[model samples]
Target: MWNYNFYIYITTNPTKTVLYVGVTNDLSRRIQEHTENKGNKNSFAGKYYCHNLIYYEHFNDINYAIEREKEIKKWSRKKKNLLIESFNPDWRFLNNEINQE
Candidate 1:
């Protein structure tokens, strides 16, 4: 459904050194939350400041999205980097584009 899509997304720190894998239905809001939560020790993404959107895959089902997210999280950095490069060759920051028309 266009109104509510599930997604498995990847976010990295400004330096692009740390990566965080997550699943969400509202991508724009989630990115905003991550940005607001940056540097909060209680959260992994926050603790590592991994709030810059780098890659994302859309899915119609939440279960499928979560499964993909879990699978990606178990992958090695090298593999994850390869995946991101496949979708985003330059690993560009995608945060600003999430809610854009």
Candidate 2:
């Protein structure tokens, strides 16, 4: 059987002012798309320039990934920030550090 990977990820603006929660199988490409979409007001991520990845969770199933994404999306910013801090204490931008293999 073929193996697949899915991710529930959180991204923020350069100033760390906003968070965008999403799920994707192709994380690097999706982040690139968000970066490309920056400043376009039609989309929330674009309007807020939320392309800097800060946190992520891996899942083997798309349904679970989507569920987790929805759960995170529902979180208050304060709760989300605490979650991110638990995973990423400094809230460092993690765009280039993962999925390189």
Candidate 3:
């Protein structure tokens, strides 16, 4: 079965200090690009070294994904922490997890 398009991602550094929110249909490719830093230096994810995949949610509809991305973008740091904590309580670096899978 094909995976559905999705958004609602939270990426961070190995230190878990920098965080980035984005929407992308191709999760694996997007994460790879971020980790490789293959984009403009001015970009938040590139500049902040937020390539670790800490959290993500899949959505079949692009509109819903976009809406959720915007909603997360507008949130405060505290709110974002809470959201991440829901899935990753220890704030672990998820890059290795993905790679091992």
Best by lDDT: 1
The segments of candidate 1 whose C-alpha lies over 4 angstroms from its true place after superposition are 1-3
Q: Which stretches of candidate 2 lie over 4 Å from their true place?
A: none
lDDT comparing candidate 3 with the true structure: 0.83
Q: lDDT scores for all predictions?
A: 0.94, 0.92, 0.83
**Residue 9 lDDT, candidate 1, scale 0-100:** 96
Clashing pairs in 2: none
TM-score against truth, every candidate: 0.94, 0.93, 0.85
Number of clashes recorded per candidate: 0, 0, 0
lDDT score, candidate 2: 0.92
**lDDT (10s digit) by residue, model 2, range 9-85:** 99999999989999999899898899899999999999999999999999998999999999989999999999999
Which candidate has the top score in TM-score? Answer: 1
Pitting candidate 1 against candidate 3, the one with the higher TM-score is 1
Per-residue CA lDDT of model 3 for 12-87, tens digit only, reads 8767787899888877778888989934588888877888888888899888999999999999999999999998
